[model samples]
Target: MKRHFNTTGPVIPEQHYCVDPMTRLDWEDVQYLIGAGKFFVLHAPRQTGKTSTLLTMMDVLNQSDEYQCLYINVEPAQAARDDVSAGMLTIVNNLVEGAAIRLKETRLRDWRETIWRNSGPHGAFSALLSRWAQESDKPIVLMIDEVDALVGDTLISLLRQLREGYIGRPGIPFPHSVILCGVRDVRDYRIHTKHHEIITGGSAFNVKAASLRMVGFNRAEIETLYAQHTAETGQAFEPMVFDALWEDTHGQPWLINAIGHELTWKDKTARDRSTPITLERYRAARERLIYSRSTHLAQLADKLREPRVHRIMAALLTGDENLSGIPVDDLEYVNDLGLVEIRPQIRISNRIYQEIIPRELTWVEQSSITHQQAWYLTPQRHIDMPKLLSAFQQFFRENAEAWIERFDYKEAGPQLLLQAFLQRIINGGGRINREYGLGRKRTDLFIEWPVDEEKGFYGDVQRVVLELKILRKSLETTLLEGVEQTAGYADQCGADEAYLIIFDRRLNVDWDDKIWQRQEQWQTRSIGAWGM
Candidate 1:
């Protein structure tokens, strides 16, 4: 079978176009750590090739005569929740089965039952590892995947067991080196016992020597992966598509592969290979991927409900810089989930995520909206900005209270509602690109509508810039600042039209006082200013 981009699971070299998993890690460092019998962590966000890397490492290590290696996923034990016995049994069974399948090692299978019966839930895992190390002719290297998936006391028991085995190391009957892998660093694990005490993973597994993080593919790696498809089938991606892909996915492995799969397979016309995938087609595929609500994207959206996620996301949406109140651990936790970037100023991780966040938040509201796209279109089929804004102002006045109350992200309700309303009107006809981040103090929205239907975005595109802000200062001061900001953004985007929307969230303000509009001139550009 011809190789294709893979998104479903660990990449199989013969069946998929893939970058070498080892290239994404510090191979030399990993080897030294294992050789020195260091217990360490290997963590990354979901679907970024953590399992694939671990599996590849296991194969590489086993191929060498140095050590016997096994990789096991303990995620199934999550079902046991606080049940330490059940969780341990499930995890040990996975280890035994994995050893048999991957290494043709049946020693674990033979000894697991007796060990569990004699040692009980807490001690069985530790005892089993000790026996495996003692029995093996060579040193044993174990890789545990989804280590954080186990919950409560079960997770605590597992960590303590690993720590117990670590104490023996080379001197006693224990694995030479063990790797615990998960979406977050082991230090972030806050396992709760049945007694309601939160035992952190750091405390439970203090024997850990180091923590290593796996990052997304870099530019050259992404290019190489895509180039594989071109080499195999002679299908070409336009140069500009690569630039857009990088911006859209930020080199996230699954997203890069997902888009590649979408372009080559999902869109039938592109399968011909002779038809080069252009930037426009790539954009369309991105749209489909987002709107399809694929399992991967849905899983990310599910994290929005978490309190830590909610707090950071709410701040990002509203452009609030008051993140001082949020704990550093909470920020780190959110960052570890791959929701946002932390170093070069905190923001959504990528353009695709930036787009997904608003759409997911306003999906229900957008669906419930009864307004027709044609109702706001001009005679030439262009979006009537003035009329749309007027209608939204009235809609906001009527439904703001009830609708805003229903949002989990109530801090960003007004802006989210506005996006929802705009999304309803522009559903199929245009695209809205959003830009917001911590300390931005405003959200910049750019709408791209194709006036010429036959040529689509290739001809006569309507570009409009909408700057959204909350009333943080006097009306006069806000209008002046907003007009300047709107003008600057319009210049950057080369938008033909510009609008500044000020949302007065003060509860003391009356509807009549808050609802208004006016025209402002900024450096020869006429900008529409609205109050709500």
Candidate 2:
């Protein structure tokens, strides 16, 4: 009954099972925060399990006997932003409430008295920490989640208050340690937006001794998670399933858990045998998980639309190697959000994200005639190249205006959308191998469909190699370039047939005269015209 994969948010505490996917991280990372008597910051993108990690760490610290750890979300402070005093008041109250809930102390008389002694909110926070330190036998540790939810003056006041109280370590009667958790690093926080100036938050919130980033699940962790499912459910994950999962997800925790959860919990109809999940099943599960674009993915993609996220993603999607010249401010912003890892030439953080970004950003196909509906069209089992192209030609004519308008990054041209159009239909049953990026010269897409010949089924396969290019001033140069470029991909893929799709955004040609024509007798390729 346990799902073999999960492609969503952090695995739920116990109702939904999980594994410690990240071995590189340990309590030791947070241990330093506790020992230093300093403020600490833990940041990563939303749904990467910041809350889980914080709760788990709280458990770890509380068991040590020497420390009393209390974790709370300062989200209530968000709406009180108009009045800094009110926001601060809400935050302190939430902290007290959170502490009381865990400690089961209805009233910490001394803590309450000290918290309200000061003239301002910052003074109140200091006094409260001071009193708590004096009353409690164990050193106090505070964890605040969703710290970023407090914005503008509210955020500034919170950071300033914490910074002002930073000196209360061993000698001073303040909380021994504190942790601020959010979607950004303390150093990257632009709490104020006056005059378009970035006042580095680190300067104001300099108390952060260290900032720890939580990475997604790795290969071994993914395997262990599935193994846990196998151990509980009696059904196993096939060896190929592991390989496919690794290749597809590359250890994204949300994706790993979500894929398994869908296959196990959501798609009951797909489950028949008590045996391991096969590679085909895994692929099917992956497609379904992606198509659903469930909450987990929605949260992840929400960041993609931010300016910082957009810049980094655009560069990655376009393969702009010139990203070396990208401003440090933007990179820091994006890196803090976990859009792309810093090392290894600044690639997308992981494979799951890589796959999701294109599909998430691409045009959505809506029709009663779904790709699955078209599945029957290939009943003879061979992909009808002519028919597929003709269908797309008609589809493009009818929908290009509307669909092209939906595209956000038109600078890369409409070729990407064209591939995405054909991709939605083929992705489930087949695979669309995409090779595009900056300085790559051209984008290439290869669509491969498998045929089953054993059920007296004929082995009819479709191999399509599509080359996309942008049209400039003259059609002559673009077409000549496309011919040379497409010829290579066709030969490389050994495509049974190839088509060159030139997106004429400029609309130099007459729309009524648009034609799909074949080119080069020797190369055995066809060229299509879809223009304004």
Candidate 3:
């Protein structure tokens, strides 16, 4: 059977299309740390190949006969919540099961029963691990996946057990190296329990030598993945397709794989392999993935409702830089959840995520809009932007206060509501590509509508650029700046027409003053400007 891109679970090298998992990590450093018996961390956003990487490393280590390696997922313990005894019991059971399956070790079964019988709840975890380690002539390497998934006393108990085991290593027959894997660094965990006890993972797991974050695949890695499919089938991707995929996904492992899967298996025409995959096909695959609400994207979209997630995302959409009151750990938490990237300036993790956030934020409002895509289409099936913007201006005038209140991201209320309206119009036959971020003070939109109404992303397509900005200064100043910015963005997208929507956020602003549209020229380019 032909190997395919995997997004559901851990990738098996021979069974699924995969890249070298160690390529995303400092493999040599990790090996050295483990060899030296230093407990450490392996963390990344979910579905970024963390589990696959650990399993691969386990195989490599066990094959070398230098150490016995086991990967156990402790996420089941999360169901026990604050019940330390129940949580530890579940975790211990999982480890014994994992060892039996992975290591073919029957001793773990006997050890589990013996440890629990002799030691009781708190002592069971360390005792079983110590027994398992001593059972092997080669020192054992313990990999606990989703170590931070549990919270409250459950999380504290797990961490403390690992730390105790780490401290007693070499002499007391504990695992030589213990690697905890999860989405966030253990230090970032501020676990709350039913008893109202707030504990930090750092204080509990203080023996951690280092925390290594696994990130999305880089540009070259993404290319290599795509290249594999092309090589196997004698089909080639258009040169620009690679750049487009990279631009949209930024090499997010799941997103990258999802695009490949959708294009190959889901897209009928693209599966033939004789027809080369073009940029149009790539963009179409992206849209299908976005609207399908695949498990990965849905998981990310779900994070928007979290308070910590809301705090950063709320500021992000509206360019609210006054985020001093937001906790640093909150920001880190959002980053860990893979909603946004922390380095190279804070922004949504990818283009699809940027689009999904607003769509999700104003989904109710979008659903409430009675207008349909056909209502905004011209005779040529082109988007009637002037009419759409005019309608939005009226909607803003009437429903701004009521609709904005519904949003956690109220500062970007106008932008979100407008997108909600536009999304309704674009949902049928076109796609909206969005670009917005912290400190951008602007949201850029590119609407791609098939002009001839052909059934694919190709054929004569109409592209329009819309720039949304908030009026922080005088209207005259903001208008001029917006005109230039809109023109620049239009030029970037190669869009024929551009519009600037400036939202007046001032108190006591009159309806007449806030609602208007005019045509202006910026550096020989004409830009339609709207005040809202």
Candidate 4:
């Protein structure tokens, strides 16, 4: 009775879940870590199924008769702040008891009580493994989940004890292999404890041998999940829907599931029959979900607002990929956050996130624009492009300043605002196609206005390519660069006309009211003012 789509973490029992791709992560390269009895760290972004992978790994290791394996979650122990060492003790005791219960060995169960009697939590953990290895004739492996939850001096003490105890291994003592799992690489930890002024966990826990990362589902996995949903519900997903979903999410597991979950559970009306999900429905569902500013979108927006994310995102939004040489902290931070993938050229990870950034940033501004329904439609039911552009000119003269301020990313707001203006006019029968990013020179927005005329006549396809430029360096320098950039983009899009709007916030000279100057056979145009 469980639906396949899950917005939260990995689905549990009764709920069908995909096998984590990272679960197949091998420890071959770091076998020395296991052999030396050193701590191992595995981490990734939240909800990327780190816990699920650990559990699966623990099960596999436990099945092997050579090693007794146990996975313990220390998240609950985090609640006890002031007495952190006591919290560690409590977590160790609980972990021992839980493992003993699972193993169902009375002697091992007694060992749990024996270990807890010791003064040190680390000593207790070591004792339990020592007893288990000696009695069962097998080495013991320990997997600690939410290891980062242990804070301050508690975290330091735990790491130090494990490092100190590494000397007693193999024949005499200590767990064979120790795995610490959390949201960040252990080497990046900056633990601040009341007792220790500033304890850099990386230096304290240099004993971490291997830092493994968990990755999300790929394209094949995405299709398989949707297919499973279709098989179960007997409701088909349109062919184009799959392509659209793949294009949007790019196999991001969370987004893939979220879209499906929203479409099936949230968007469906009571009277609507169990029908196949279409591309239109999927789009509507995504737009609605984004507009609602759900937890997923809100959290993503919050990341965008961070100073680290802000700079990198601004560069990406304005399509400034030249920061490749500039050592910006925000660039690295945003890349680490997985918002933008680091490659030969830094860019947003996928289409869905790329689409999300602009929409989430500009939704407030778009909502404020008054309805201009009359200007777009004609008596013959065809779109009036001249009327639409005239309206945009008036809008640019009036609301551009106020609207741009409302945008989350004011740098790219002007272009988005223009799109919003054009979108209102053309969205009725026409669609807008956008392409933007870093190193791409300029952001190219293509507005497709389709018009149906008489029977023999071809559909009036109006393609408007808008090129956005920022006011930095020099207008001539940027414009020369923009012209070449816009030319290439216009050629690719096969656009009939291209409008190069320079948003000059740095201009000191007064405008001559109507400054619409065209150059090079009308291939390019320049306009400057407060906004328009």
True-structure Cα RMSD, model 2 = 4.4
The collision pairs in model 3 are none
Q: What is the lDDT of residue 154 in candidate 2?
A: 73
lDDT of 4: 0.66
lDDT string, candidate 4, 1-532, tens digits: 7556777765663586465533336646445566666678877655666777777666666676656778778777777664755877767766667676765555756666657676456566556666666776666678888877777767776676667566565556667788888866676556787865777667777777777776667667777777777676677778888888887765566777788877777875611437778776787676555556677667676778865577678778887765655555455546545677777768887776776677667666556667566657777655564555556766775676777787777777767787676655554455566666776656777766554634211356766676776656576676677676666667788777666666655446443433344453224532221124
List TM-scores for all candidates, in order: 0.98, 0.82, 0.95, 0.75
Candidate 2 residue 23 C-alpha distance from true site, Å: 3.7
Q: Which ten residues in a row have the lowest lDDT in candidate 1?
A: 163-172
Per-residue CA lDDT of model 2 for 1-532, tens digit only, reads 3344433444454656666533425676667668877788888776667877777778778887779989889988889764777888887787777778886644554366455754477567666667677778888898989988876777776777778767545566777888999988887776664344556678878877888887767777778777777777777777888787876665666677778876676768546538567666676677777778778677778777776667667766754456666679789778777667777567666656666777667745332224442643556676665566666666676677777676665555355565666666675567676665544545677877776545211244567787766565377676777777777788888887776766565466655555455554335555443332
TM-score of 3: 0.95
TM-score of candidate 2 to 2 decimals: 0.82
lDDT of 3 by residue, 233-304 (tens): 888889998888887888789989988899888998877889888888888788888888777877787878
Tell me the tens digit of each residue's lDDT in model 1 across 241-317: 98999999887888999999899999999989999989999988998888888889999999999887999999999
3 or 4: which has the higher TM-score? 3
Ranking by lDDT: 1, 3, 2, 4
Model with the higher lDDT, candidate 2 or 4? 2
